[model samples]
Target: MAALAHRLEDDDHLSDADFIKISNLIGQQVGIKLPPSKRLMVEGRLRRRLRALDLASFSDYGDYLFRLDGLETEITYLINAVTTNKTDFFREPEHFELMQKKLVAELIAQRRDRLPLLKVWSAASSTGAEAYTAAMVLADMVAQRRDFRFAVLGTDISTDVLDIGRRAIYPAEQVVPMPPGMQSRHLMQARRPGARPEVRIVPELRRLVRFDQLNLMDESYPYDRDVDIILLRNVLIYFEKADQAKVISRLVGHLRPGGYLLLGHSESMIGTSITMRQVAPAVFQKT
Candidate 1:
């Protein structure tokens, strides 16, 4: 019965009004057009938002959002509400493995590269697992190297999860992929009396990360630093083709010379002139 109750939490259904209300709201804000077929997903994301915001129904919230003048706060609430953060520490081993051998050593050897930064913007960084995972990779690589230099920027649209990111804590299951040797060096495990398995990122590795808010569709982006790597993973599948192209163009525009774009294994930029050439199954290099 207890297991059944937990399963029920993942199961959600949206009403017609809610389907339209959320679809239009997200579309207007982030330009993500939610179609009718995705109604249930929108409902699931919004359910958490509704509970957190203490709103009764989609219609009521919609009216409130529509009437609201300052959109930043409300937008922050929506970003945190809509996205799912189900990531682990070593979720993608290949990319990190590559960085360990080539990127890390090179960055470390550049003695004159002061203020040098290597960033892999986990654009959809949810609960910060992905960003922290990347941070772990850099930390491990640079810890023994004498002249190492790096930083990771994790950005997301969700304010709620961003809060979780800043908190830098996670349940045991979510942090499992990390190995024991690296785990101790990278994460600070926490388990108070009668509490469950939880972990927080330690200060050393935490300093290497800077998390912030980002909207993929926004034209006037605030970031000016050139990124060495950009991880716009499975999140792009949610956007329409034209929107995907637009976002890719914007993301690629920020990549540094010879930097890489690491995408989800299933995502692609088949026909876009984002100036990136495919390097592997889901990896691309700026041309």
Candidate 2:
């Protein structure tokens, strides 16, 4: 252990060859592109894994990662370490506005007869913010229409983020982006003495949303085909165009005809091959 610690102290940086291997493996497993520009960022993130595993260097970590037995157990930790999970309550306010003003009513009217329950999928939900935001919006709608009912599914490649989502606890400041009154209605504060300032989503709202581990690069997802709305936002920028299109096409298969697909503002140009018409900026509907 002393020698291993000395070796780790001597080799602190990720080697170029090891970085390339890691970048390629990440791309293959999760459809994320990690170019040379991100080498430092990758090294910074993976350092946590090295510390966790007590590995001597990036090369040592790489050896364990590529081995079949180690790969099976370490893949989740690797993805969790490197994946970017920037999220906040109501990150894009306009998307929620559109949901409340137009989409929900239309979806409910369209499926009222056969399927009364509206299903929403947050395809790249990071820490449950987007999914919980959607739930808060839909839950508000239920007050106006007694027949309205909904379910939200939040999926991400990082199990770490999903676990955070499932817990529904966040720092108190993270709720600032949420509209007035919504916070009071949906969040419970942790006010005990010496407790850090934090808030948890109310039980009622948490009940309406569920988080799951999912990789968009997989050939198929285990979800229902009649989803009413799918939010694949802010994540496609990490992929190559081909992978982006493939992911969009696969997600479209899960939506019902007339269901909506919401993308990040920058991702509007891709997914042209799919039979979906643009309904709003970064929003599309199946034809």
Question: Number of the top candidate by TM-score?
Answer: 2
List ranges where model 1 is wrong by over 4 Å: 1-18, 44-75, 105-115, 191-193, 269-274
RMSD of 2: 2.9
TM-score, candidate 2, is 0.93
Q: Which window of 10 residues has the lowest lDDT sum in candidate 1?
A: 103-112
Q: Model 2 off-target regions past 4 Å?
A: 1-11, 67-69, 193-195, 271-273
What would the TM-scores of all predictions be?
A: 0.82, 0.93
Ten contiguous residues minimizing lDDT sum, candidate 2: 266-275
lDDT (C-alpha, whole model) for all candidates:
0.71, 0.88
Q: Which predicted model would earn the best lDDT?
A: 2
Q: How well is each residue in 123-242 modelled by candidate 1, as lDDT tens digits?
A: 878778888888888777666763556778888777767788888977876777787887788777665723577778898878878889888888856775478778877777777877
